[model samples]
Target: MLQDNFGRRFYYLRLSITDVCNFRCNYCLPDGYECDHDRDFLSLAEIKRLAAGFASMGTEKIRITGGEPALRKDLPDIIQACKQTNGIKTVAITSNGFKLAEHLPTWVDSGLDALNVSIDSFDPRQFQAITGKDKLDEILSGIDNGLSSGFTNIKINTVLMREYNAHDINSFFNYVKDKPVSLRFIELMQTGDNKDFYQQQHVSGQHIKNQLLANGWLPTIRHKAAGPAEVYAHPDYQGTIGLIMPYAKDFCDTCNRLRVSSLGKLHLCLFADEGLSLKEQLQIDDPLPLQRRIMSLLNDKQATHFLNEGFTGATKHLSMLGG
Candidate 1:
């Protein structure tokens, strides 16, 4: 297995198929926010080539991400291409769930192992306010479609903000309590040029934990999967609620993930701005040299991020890098 300097085994790769998104979420991609690397976007063929080469080096789990991966025209084709690679055990996608229902069967047939949908609030108005759109009904319908899509696993990602959706925590839990889905609460991270927005609405993992305690939730240890969230299953409820406390509790000490942007730049940390390029190498007929370069980068991976006090750092957008 290819391991990083932290001794963390590098097995999971979150690949962004596209940087463009349909909706303008407030926390992640705010209004009038244009992505920096739009001009350098990679083609479908190049994405497949890099994925195939990465699998050969030891990547076992792959998740297709985007500003909205569903916005990509040939998403199913891209999913199929990723699965066609060797050494990849699990293949999933993170989507805004906009047009998921229309492509349900095709998504299933494309070898999709799991799906994580971004749903912030249960209230329609709040949803609109948060996502900067009024398509809550479409998203809800997509969830129903996703459940009926026969996916092996389904996860709901909710970014917890201080006064915005924090009070609705109980309601959010009540909404999905008996359902067969895992609800994940993500702490907002300060990334990109939106430092002011993040600071204004930042909520830590402890804040979420305290809220759960207020509602009589007893803390319990959870299984650490490849995903960043630290999950906790409700004892009485059928479904689980996870807390991705990236700002509160650091998971970088055991970080084992590597990400590739839609433009073919490899990101070592989720919060890191600069990334290593693989576009040129992927264009070559042989990908062995490209694979060796990836291996070398993995060997030089840092143990932790520099988030709180410059001690640990993760650089990349949560949306672009796959939450």
Candidate 2:
């Protein structure tokens, strides 16, 4: 198993298949995707090898992330590739849910175990304002389609921004009181280029957490391979709420995930300044060198991201890290 010197176990891998997203979210890519250099993302063969490498090291969960993962036409094939890996148990994807209702059937056939869709606001105009897209209705319909298609664990990700939708929590609560989906409220984080914007709009996840606790939402025991969200359940509600609060104290203590860029760089943490290029090792078509390299280098992984200290690291935007 891949265990850091700090004794934090690694069981999940968030792999960014591409950095191309169509949405122009205010916090992420407000101007839409701009190719800085040749985005020679990993090929299918390389992805297969990478999945195998992680599986060999006891990684059980692989989350496919991207600027918007569904943009790739061959996404079903990619999901199938990770699912076919011997030791990989759960294959999930995070997307903007661009055409999820249309594509979810094929994705389910390819063994996708879970889905997380980004929906920043419940109000259509506010959603359009935040995402630069007028597809909130379509995305919500896609989520409904997921429910009808047997997706019992569909998660809707909402970035909590003071200026955007933080105060409008009632809309989310009412929506979730009936649906069995999970609503995740993520705190607006400071990326390398978003310092000014972060200062202007950042909302602590604690704000929402406090409200939930007061409303009688009880924390749920997390599964061993779950991601970094602190989940909660309410007796009267069908859905659950999750809070991804990076700035919360002891947030990094349960670090169980590692990130890989679309170009094959291993980012030890989302806010890590440096990443080790595993591209050369990925080309060998063997899991040993890749596994060994990841296992060895993880000893240097930081015990904390130091997000509270205002360090945003090399990540210029959420899209760069597939957030």
* Highest-TM-score candidate: 2
Please, what are the lDDT tens digits per residue for candidate 2 over residues 59-162?
99999999888878789999999999999999999999988899888999999999999998999999999999999999999989889867877998999999
**TM-score against native, each model:** 0.90, 0.98
Predicted structure 2, TM vs. truth: 0.98
Task: State the lDDT of candidate 1 residue by residue for 1-323, as single tens digits.
Answer: 66776677778888987777777788777763466654566777887788788788678888989878887778888888888887788888888888767775688799888888889888899888888888878877877876765563888888888767977788878866777788888887777555777778887767667767776665556322377666666678767778887655547866767889877888887766467888779897587888788887766566566677532134434566664
Candidate 1's C-alpha lDDT? Answer: 0.75
lDDT of each: 0.75, 0.91
The superposed Cα distance between candidate 1 and the true structure at residue 135, in angstroms, equals 1.2
